[model samples]
Target: MKILITGSTGQLSQALQTALAGEGKVLALGHKVMDLTKPMQIRQQVRLLRPDLIINAAAYTAVDPAQGDRDQAYAVNAIGPEVLAEEAAALGVPLIHYSTDYVFDGRKPEPYHEEDEPRPLSIYGASKLAGEQAIQAVGGQHLILRTSWVYSLHGRNFLLTMQRLLQERDTLSVVDDEVGAPTWAGTIAAVTADMVRKWRTGTGGPSGLYHLTATGETSWYGFACSIAQNLERQGLLRARLEPILSADYPTAAERPLNSRLNCARLQRDWGMVLPDWEAALHQCLGNANAHQANHSMQATQSL
Candidate 1:
């Protein structure tokens, strides 16, 4: 099957590319090749590629900046998927889109199920919710995967940010109120590939919105503490970690206090299971260390 993946350079898309390498002909399109903000460009590219499947991983992810950039955010996160769904419907192809757990207001005390009513509190969440709605309105073959706190070894994510900050600073403060799973991009990509393969083989269940995230939950402060502990074990710098409330670190957008998503439906239907946040983090950091060691060896050999 020929697959077209948007946001090629992004963390999730990069993982998808690697995961889907043996699936079929994969055409990776970055912003330079296909800008999500431009509907006409999206239409033209989809027409040109005529791919069997289109996985939209591109999104306007600047939550704080989105408060002042609603238009751009909607253009990419909302209108882009709408246009993609329309094109997919026209071509009779399935479209796989990614959404966010931010769609919830975080008022719920328990984990959010797939059927939970979304009450977005911030502009970014609203835009992403709009995207999900727009795709459903198009009435096409689509699978909307709502994930949370996605990070990877690559990309500008909280993990890398903490790693850098821990090395550069003596003390670090993280919000302890906001709770969610720190999902690894590679895990999402691998599961996506499995779902796609099952679909192709006519074994995958019906398509709809499903929550895909790590097994457990943690606050930003807890996540940072875990990262710091691992880094210190690896002979990295040790920094004093401080836990603070969300209000202590103000931002343009209001984040949800609870971002936990229930993955029961995904597991029941697709038979997909992801590692816990802590396990995934350990593997990710281990891979990073291996990569660095290989690079250093290559450099020394060249000298």
Candidate 2:
């Protein structure tokens, strides 16, 4: 299988590259090489590469900035995805595109499911929701995987941000009210590889939307505390954590308070289940390269 993964520099894409290393001839494309905003360029690349599978990991993820930059957000998130779906359908290939939990308004008491009606609360969320709908409308062989609170050992994420702040500041405040699972990029990549393996064996399920996240849930403050606890064990942490509500610190983009998504359907359909958030975090931190990467990031931030 010739796998084409977009967003080469992103955390999840990088992890996917590693996970799918031996599975096929993987061609990961970065923004400079494959800009999602340009439909013509996307078509050109898809036609040229003629990949057997296209995994669209690219997205406009700047939640707050998206409020003022709606056009660019939609261009990349909505329009671009629609084009990709069309192209993938034209090629008669599967397009594994990643969506977000932000598609919901977070009003429901329970976890969001695939059948839940999305009511996005921000431009970024709305854009991503549009992309999901567009792809579905295209009626192509696509897996719209909605994930939440994605982090990794490398790249910019809550984990890396907390790691640096916890080391530098005497005190740090994180939102406690907004809750979701902190999913590791590594876990997502591995699960994706598993799905690809199943597909190769001709035992995959029907193409549709699905939720893929860590098993357990936690608030941003809770996630930070866990990061601290893990770092403290390694003598690399120092900070007094403070919990605050979402209202305490507002942003341009309204985020979903309840980011938790029920993964029972995914497991039932695909026989896939993720590890708990804490265990995944522990496993991610256990990587020796993580320490070096964290130090490098912190140093870069200081300079």
Candidate 3:
């Protein structure tokens, strides 16, 4: 089955590309190839690809920047998916998309279920929720997976930020008040591929919203410290780190206090279990190490 993935260069898209390479045909398009900002571009691309499934991995993910750039965010996160869903509906294809845990105000005491009514805390969350509404409104075969605190080998994410800061600075402070699962993009991508493949088969079940995240939870402080510990174990520690609350690390946007998502529904329906956040973080750091090694090797080869 031919699958078309938008946001080809993003972390999740990169993971999906690597995971789905041998399984089936994946047409992963970047901004240059399929600019989602333009609705006509999405419509034309969907028509041309004629894919069985269109996984929209692209998003306007500048959470803080989104506070000031509502138009750009709405175009990419809200209206862009609306256009994609319309075109996919026209072509009779399943649309798989990603949402965020930010949709909730983070005031909930327990893990958020798929049925929980979304009350977005910030503009980014509001925009993503809007996109989710659009996909659902289309009434097509769609799977909207809401994930949180995503990190990967090839992206501007928390893990990378911690690693970079650890390399450059002598001391660091991270927010501990905010909590959520540090989900790995690779895990999300792999599970997505499995879901899509099942859909292709006769056994694939209904399409709806689900939460896909790592097994456990941690704060930015704990997550960063774990990375630091791992780096120390690897003899690469270079920075001193301190744990602080969300108030210490102020941002333009207000972060949810509890970003945990309940994946029981997803696991029960899809028969999948994601790794723990700590394990996922280790893997991301490992990937970063591998990437650095590759770059060094290429430089040596050129010399």
TM-score for every candidate vs. truth? 0.98, 0.95, 0.94
Candidate 2: worst 10 consecutive residues by lDDT? 284-293
User: Which portions of model 2 miss their true places by more than 4 Å?
Assistant: 289-303
Encode model 1's per-residue lDDT on 147-256: one tens digit a residue. Answer: 99999988899999999999888899999999999999988998999999999999997889999998888999999998898888778876799999999999989999
- For residues 115-169, what per-residue lDDT tens digits would candidate 2 score against the true structure? 9999999999999999999999999788999999999977889999999999999
lDDT of each: 0.94, 0.92, 0.88
Candidates ranked by TM-score: 1, 2, 3
Error of 2 at 14 (Å): 0.4
Highest lDDT against the true fold, candidate? 1
Better of 2 and 3 by lDDT: 2
In candidate 2, which residue pairs clash? none
lDDT of 3 at 13: 94
Local lDDT at 27 for model 3: 97
Question: Number of clashing residue pairs in every model?
Answer: 0, 0, 0
- Candidate 1 contains a number of clashing pairs equal to 0
Q: Could you tell me how far off, in angstroms, the CA of residue 7 lies in candidate 1 after the best superposition?
A: 1.1
lDDT by residue (tens digit), candidate 3, 40-142: 8888888887988888999999999999999999899999999988988888888999999999999999989999999997899999999999999998888
Query: Who wins the TM-score comparison?
Result: 1
- What order do you get sorting by lDDT, best first? 1, 2, 3
Name the runs in model 1 displaced over 4 angstroms.
none
